[model samples]
Target: MQNIENKVAYITGGSKGIGFGIAKILVENGLKVAISGRNLDDLQEAQAVLGEDNLLVFQSDVINFEDEVNSVKRVIERFGKLDVVIANAGVGKFAPVDEISLDDWNAMIATNLTGVFHTLKASVEELKKSKGYYISIASLAGTNFFAGGAGYNASKFGVVGFTQAAMLDLRKHDIKCTTIMPGSVTSNFADHVPSDSDAWKIQPSDLGEMVIHLLQMNANVLPSKIEVRPSKTS
Candidate 1:
């Protein structure tokens, strides 16, 4: 219903799972999308799945500042303007507090929190020009802590804090910011994918549809923080 026929969106971690799912739906809704991943092979495969006409693939690491900038540059060059940006790339390594390594903690922070900063920094000007939207895919772990998830929690909680502040700062520019938190999504998260044993888990498409729903919301109102969970968790 919301017409995005010419709007351009850039989604990171889009080779598979929730990122790719959102990319697919955005394309179906007539938005031009640029999807990024670290692996060229995965990006190519995702491109094929989504059809190359409405989807562009960029192979870049979100943790790398130059690569993130180049990705935004490429999208602007191709689409002329960027109307939306989703910082959906993330990584997690679970370990008890005493067992967590510095490398693991840094990786979580870099990709989950700093990666988002890079994403917004790279695209902020275009978003200001177009009065666009920015969304970050955080996690329930951000608000609800659990053991062995300290690093992940820290990153996501930081994402929530950062995006909320950004929302305040960017509102005057007419650029919206939102943080989406989901629980137990059925993905290759921590190397676990959907299976019969996981029939009740939240599918990536569910979150994909949510992204579409958020985009279609009336411009006058902002859904700043959305918390999503499976309705019938067993």
Candidate 2:
């Protein structure tokens, strides 16, 4: 197993939901964490809740390459080094293929797929120095298709494929990479509010635990692609 104490981590979309959950876990595990979001208010709120001692908050949009680059730079500057980078910023829009607007499709592509690319590209150099871990929060939709999921499916599928290829590429440099594909997570993503209907679904903190487990895995082991789902249907 790897020793993860006192390491530095940067997580995109870390203001809420799964990203926030993961950031909390990292901080609890003695890892210095930098959490980024486009909303400074949300970021500040998270920082207050998480703690100021080992947490850094940044305003960033993963869809913007410069934002990603600056976020990474800020993390490195504040922490002196970065050992983990998680790309968890994403948006979802569900609609029939014919009903999906060009704008919606483009938005999903830019934020979900291209955003992960930007995050990885901006942090890859720092990761190489630390032989760190790079993780992307994809979705089960990457593999399974539903009736109203053309745009989302395309973006997630791209994320899965991109993460796998990145994993193979980074392994040679001793940098680990993985994609976490989850199903039916209870969160307010894409304007959906979590309620009792989602009790049977995966919780945001479950992903945080999964990341902690991955970080503690043996250096020789790499669970590159993980799919987590609810134990039972609701």
For all predicted structures, in order, the TM-scores are 0.97, 0.98
Count of clashing residue pairs in every prediction? 0, 0
In model 2, state the lDDT of residue 17: 87
Residue 63 deviation, candidate 1, in Å? 0.9
Q: What is residue 148's positional error in candidate 1, in angstroms?
A: 0.5
Location of the lowest summed lDDT over 10 successive residues in candidate 1: 190-199
> Tens digit of lDDT per residue, candidate 1, span 1-234?
455677899999999988988888888888999999898988989888999887789888989989889999999889899999999999989999899999999999999999999999999999999999999999999899999999999999999999999999999999999999999788877777668876687788888788888778888889999998888877
Highest TM-score against the true fold, candidate: 2
Residues 1-234, model 2: lDDT tens digits:
778899999999999988998999888889999999988998999998999999999899988999999999898889899999999999988899989999999999999999999999999999999999999999999999989999999999999999999998889999999999999898879988778888898998889889999999999999999999999997
Prediction 1 TM-score vs. true? 0.97
**After superposition, which runs of candidate 2 have C-alpha atoms over 4 Å from their true positions?**
none
